[model samples]
Target: MSTFPTSLTCTSLSFAWPDGTAVFDDLQVAFGPGRTGLVGVNGSGKSTLLKLIAGELTPADGTVRVAVEVGYLPQNVTLDTALRVDEALGVAATRAALHAIEAGDATEEHFDVVGDDWDVEERTLATLGELGLGHIDLDRTVGEVSGGESVLLRLAALLLRRPDALLLDEPTNNLDLYARRRLYAAVEAWSGIMVVVSHDRELLDLVDQIADLHDGRITTYGGNFTAYEEALAVAQEAAERMVRVAESDVRRQKRELIESQTKQARTDRKGRQLAASGSHGKALMDAMRRRAEETAGRNKHLHEGRLDDARRRLSEAEETVRVDEEIRIDLPSTAVPYGRIVLTVEDLEIAYGTGASRALTIGGPERIALTGRNGAGKTTLLRTIAGDLPPVAGRAEVHVPMRFLPQRLDVLDDTLTVAENVARFAPRATNNVIRARLARFLFKGARADQRADTLSGGERFRASLAALMLADPAPQLLLLDEPTNNLDMASVRQLTAALASYEGALIVVSHDMPFLESLGITRRLHLEGGELKEIDREAVGYPS
Candidate 1:
């Protein structure tokens, strides 16, 4: 740990959702100066804790103490499109004052506004440049920047504040490779109490330590994400070994208890036979019978106590084992014949307002990865193919049943439950059938009844995925846009597992290289400079 002073401290912090979902109860944690990666499975309250610390949500009990200024960047960032870049950066007034003073109209109020930030404009430009927004002019409207750039701009605003403590939630969710690199650099250069909640492995690797939030508790591990994983592997191995030992002990104790009972029964039978045969006087036989009865009761109690102790040990051991379930389903109907044409783009022009055009044909069950820099119209192309957007020119056609999983995952109705969402896609399927299929997605029983709006980032993604995959007419061609955007690592693995079972043609537009590689992408396409180009994996900047 760094020698810097503590910037944030939570003392017995407690919080719950309006629906009475308890997230944290008497949770306590402290962060000193240095970068800390906060990680956990989806819905494990990583984001919730950050919100609590950031004061975005109020706690029902306990206290959160922040000794310094705090800056927070939430998962989704929205800015007023009409606002100028400087205004969005929170430096518009100071910049204006400085300019007025330079122009010899130095009013006292302007002097007060300018204060000591006379170089605010230069500092703003420098910060923007550091975040790969050097091309963005201070006078440009927020509408001019792309979504990814908008996120960076928000972060730039936070940096400009120079808060002593920073909390970032999934900051790299929509960032492309180049933008991600810039964010990574900013993280590396930070020197303060920085707590980041993200599943980006590359970004997590730069942290000074890792904080794992699970089961309403936080466990700190010294070192980066890789080191934390190694340590966790060791702990899990030990826990599993203990569970095996405990199971064996329970079996042994059970056998011993049974043997003791059998021995007592045999002794009782022998005593009864002696007593019936009149081998001893009546008084002596009665006394011996009482003694035997007492001994049997004592032995039974001892054996029972031992058995209970063994079971307790087994239960404790089992609790130590982690439960990270993966989604496993077989969608054989989604398969396409080897020579069948699945989709064709005949000189199609996307509605990206950039006149980007592409002509392509996808056959069989090929998996295609669409990649490019931000603002390259990958999402627009996917939308056109999904029939949600009309092509500006030419024609895009799908020869088979198709489904689209958009980046926002807005397909599900907020008022509907997970099962209901699935049923919406598979209108003819019975509730029982939908429930069974949803169970494979890990939404068994009451989980299937959860409202779409109530789901965490990961759960929502799984729900959206389940709906698409469990449709009545199986989708032979699936179009996905940034499917892994806000998912945690475990959820990402679950998605990969689910896709492995999908034998359909796929066209995924994403910045996640690992996920594309996991899908065994048969082809790569890049949208660049207002045109589609077939490229090798290296051209897409993915490792071989």
Candidate 2:
């Protein structure tokens, strides 16, 4: 932790996609020294804002101002496989110069390159070690590392620069449990102006504050994620109450308007009767009728205005109540009978480069949590079970219809609409049937018509999940690999809700402990040393 006067400020920042989708409009936000956890539902522009601040994308209008140097770690990190660890860390040139000087070739240029950083190699190794990359050699190429390690390597590069302001977008998306712990520790130790966009609750719990980006605005809340949740709970409660009051007011106004209309109709009939009865002079009767008509019109206009106001209030109140849609679907077709063999892998070996293998059996509707370190072939095993890969040694037998949701979610066709994608999976299903089910997944009407490429991360996940769940014959054995990797809290909740209704045997490979526990896992298995070892939740280093 360093006491540096650093800040990140956005002034009237506005941005829109090329397709004319407006993300932010004249948004103004400022982040000073301290860790700020940026959270919002997917598609709320959290990542877009981070990109704008990082100067990766130019805002359509306004400006982003930073008081100090900045470092950014994007959500998807790609590294040149041929580049060495030292090159990726941006210290290769300096290290070369230092080596040259050490070799007694003390050229002026070499001295200039090595100036004041004679221990650059040591610092680089130390930083990598701090990020749990100590075993990685500086001379080793990036192709030798795992995806999670690559992310950490990128972060390590940024850490070596020691920027005053830092921004991280979903840094824990690909990290294993151990790597996530290291990242949490790093976030805890940071004291500069830091903003992290993530949906990992445990990671967010380490932040000094929470910045909720919603509806093109950022609202800052003091304390960690727990405190922010508490505040949100209170706000939602109040908003619900307001909605109720508004509903009552609207009902009352509607009743009054009806009563006024009825009274006016009665008055009109009475006036017509009086004029027809000739109880007064013709001219006097006509004048009285005119006066009555004017009064009736004015009263009608007043009542209508009141009713409109009440309706407007109700709409505003409803807007304040967050619409966290839940997936509601019945999956009785996916049910597996008790003692039924769902999946069996005997001496199975994945075809990937990782020499990992597994031997296991899943029965009934058992919920299994697959846990392992990064590069341990968890994904490879899942792919093998999904029939995407042939086993190098043995066979995997699936007794029932199965579906696998991969981390990349590339199962969808970007050129097709969401409904079309679902139809591709369940070809027999009529458009009406597909739409009816997609509505439960929250892709109603026009949303279902939206192209797969146009959906946000959360929306795409929902569409993919819908396609799997609605597939023909149903998925009696469901496999999800890192399902919650890029999902926001709301999407995760929706996923949990959808899974609750599923009566199938499930094998979920994930590092998200809380999500796994919420599924009521019947067994926890650790994939290590080419074997599946059953363990308890606590044994896997997860908080019980």
Candidate 3:
């Protein structure tokens, strides 16, 4: 095996926006050889931390230490316009050559200075071949390639350079199951330090360690996500047990206090009655008074102590309650009836241009998920159903009310405000009702009036959903295409929850495995060659 570098480390590393709103603080973690998974809710700074480690961004506080060279794959990448696959790889190879020359292994004069650099061409082609793209059309423009292919091309470029450590952010987002498996196998075989930022829980099992980021802090676990989740469950249960014990203690203390107060009242009453009878009664009253005072003093002291202890116990219970709150989930209401069949595709055929046969087809009130490679006709099938594109062959039918929320959310006018978008969809809804609905979706007050273009990806998703929900009868069948693409963890969870309970039939095309799982998807339509086939849930694994 090749000698590996020491692990990557961070010391008191912190980051925040320029405005000083803290996102993370006093964080420390060490990652070494073997696969390490970075897991966290959205907006927990997972992506930001990865960027900092890759030196793509500077930390606001402390330091990021790299024990060896690092190879980074960003979560989102835009390949240069009009560049051919081979040409793009050529550029990557040239940079690698420069790095070699800078290290004193080669001289610039040894090769031709300008275009068509022979050594760089050879090196780039070899790297591309290793990535299973050796037979691809080298001259094909990147603009014509699918998103998944673009991601692979970027990785191929990085692989050509061969850094010792790798930092991948959502590396499987754009990939299909086949490509994902291939990448997972490759990473498992590599003997180097790797830190992967991913939401796919199934992917987490491939890791040797797991780190969970929540509320600006990180907790490291010795096992993968499944183990971490099991540990978390155990901890939550233990905390709840402790809370119950403390609550019981408080109730017992209160009961004791009440009994002691009652006994004191009786002693005082008896002493008063004895004093009312004179002489012998007076003597009795004096003794009774002394005894009552002694009892009262003891009771007061004991009750005070118990109160103090109870307060302390209550404080501890509050902490446990806070931990429980971290796991809460919120899904929106699609609030509609089973209604009638919304979409029907009979002999529906989808293909790329004239590339052979149909990718998929279905009919009835089917809650189908179309999944395949980037170039495969997943989205095409959805578009054909949504009327965005004409089906290449076969027939399609639409019945009940329907709405389309494309990944880009093109349904809303960019120049319009959130309220305007909602109003447009529900023409009968009053202005006040429109605003109220937007607020429920988290676009409140002034945010509801902001231009569609100004909203963040999550905000836009919610806005789009609000508009869809406002449809008088509600969309009986909803078509979503990669709806969770750029959403933060919180938003993804919220969206997933809403979809899980949505009453209408849904036909979704997504690459997000975790999102699909959260929605309780039990079946999938695996599109390949030119047909639709049902696959068991276990047969198609998605990241958690």
Ranking by TM-score: 1, 2, 3
lDDT of 2 by residue, 1-544 (tens): 3454536889999998755668899999998888999998877888889989989999999989876889999887899999999999999999999999889997999999988998899999888888889999999999888888999999999998889888999899778988888888888888788999888988889999999988888899999999999999999999999999999999999999999999989998988898888889999988988898899899989999999999999999999998755556656477899999999888886765566555788999999988888777788888888999888888899999999998878899999999999999999999999999999888888778888876776677888988998899889999998888778887787788778878999999888878987898888887776676788655645421
Off by over 4 Å in 3: 1-8, 17-22, 56-62, 65-68, 90-130, 275-298, 321-341, 344-364, 387-399, 407-467, 470-473, 483-500, 510-544
Candidate 1: global Cα-lDDT?
0.88
Cα lDDT for residue 41, candidate 2: 81
Off by over 4 Å in 2: 1-7, 261-291, 325-332, 351-358, 413-420, 429-436, 444-455, 536-544
Q: Which one wins on lDDT?
A: 1
> Where does candidate 1 have its weakest 10-residue lDDT segment?
535-544
**What would you estimate as the lDDT of candidate 3?**
0.71
Which portions of model 1 miss their true places by more than 4 Å? 1-4, 537-544
Candidate 1: TM-score?
0.95
lDDT of 2 at 29: 94
On lDDT, the stronger of 1 and 3 is: 1
Q: Could you estimate the TM-score for every candidate?
A: 0.95, 0.88, 0.75
Please give, for residues 7-101, the per-residue lDDT of candidate 3 as tens digits: 68888998875435466689887777878898775446777888888998788888888878888888776798599776665564454555566
